[model samples]
Target: MSLAFLLLTMGLVCLVAGGALALNVRGCAHALERKAAGNAELAMHARGELGQPQLVMSARLYRCLGTVFVLCGIVLTPYGFLELA
Candidate 1:
C-alpha cells in the first residue's frame, strides 16, 4: 500500500530472484570449469594457459548480477521495514 511496503516487497522479490539466479550461475560456472579443464590447452593457449576468456566472463557476469541483486535487496529491505513501521 505505502511506499515503504512496496519497497519491502520489491526487496524481498529481489532477494529471492537473486538467490535463484546465483544458484543457476553457480551451476554454469561449475560446468565451465569442467569444460575448461577438458580443453585447457586450446582454451588458454593464446593466453599462455591462463584460462578461457568467454567462460570466465560469463561466470563473472552472472556473479556480478547476483551480487547486484542481493545488494539491492539488502539495501532496500531495511529502509522499507523501518519506514513501514
Candidate 2:
C-alpha cells in the first residue's frame, strides 16, 4: 500500500508537470515559431558545421513529449491502486 501510494503520488506529479509544460508551450507558440525560423536561417548559413543551430527549442517536440508524459502518468496513477476487486 505504501508503494502504491508512492507511485500514485509520483504519477500525479508527472501529470501536473506534463500538463504545465504542454500549456506553457501553447502559450509561447509564437515565440517558439520565431525562434525556429531563426534557427532554420542559421542552419542554412552554416558552411563547415552541421550542428550550428543546436540551441533551438522545438515546440512540437516538447508538446509531443509532454503528451506522452501525461499519458504515462495517467496509466501509472491508475496502476497504483492496491486492489481492483
Candidate 3:
C-alpha cells in the first residue's frame, strides 16, 4: 500500500515538473538562442571569420527530456493504479 502510494506520488511529481518545463520550452529556447547569437557575434568580432563553437542549450533537448519525464509519469501512474487493483 505504501509502495503504491509512493509510486503514485512520484509519478504525479514527474508529470507536474515535465508539464512546467514544457510550458516554458519556447521562452527558454528563445533566451538560449539569443545568448548564443550574442556569443556568435563576439566570436566573429575576435576570430576573423573563423567560427568559434558556442555552447548553446538547444530547445529540443528540453522538449525531449520533458517528454521522457511525462512518459515515465504516465507509465508510472498507471502501474500505481494497477497495483491497487
Please report the candidate that would top lDDT against the real structure: 3
After superposing candidate 2 on the true structure, give the runs of residues whose Cα lies further than 4 Å from its correct spot.
Answer: 25-52, 55-57, 83-85
Indicate the worst ten consecutive residues by lDDT in candidate 3: 24-33
Tell me the whole-model lDDT of each prediction, alpha carbons only: 0.73, 0.71, 0.76
Question: What is the lDDT ranking, best to worst?
Answer: 3, 1, 2
- Cα lDDT tens digits, model 3, 42-80, are 888787876655656676676677778888999889888
Query: What ranking of all candidate models by TM-score puts the best one first?
Result: 3, 2, 1
Tens digit per residue, CA lDDT, model 2, 1-85? 7778877987898798777666765465446656787878676677555554554557766667678878888988888874321
- Per-residue lDDT of candidate 1, residues 1-24 (tens digit): 499989999899989877666676
Better of 2 and 3 by TM-score: 3
Clashes of 1: 0
Candidate 2 overall lDDT versus native: 0.71
Between candidates 1 and 2, the lDDT winner: 1
RMSD of each: 6.8, 5.4, 5.2
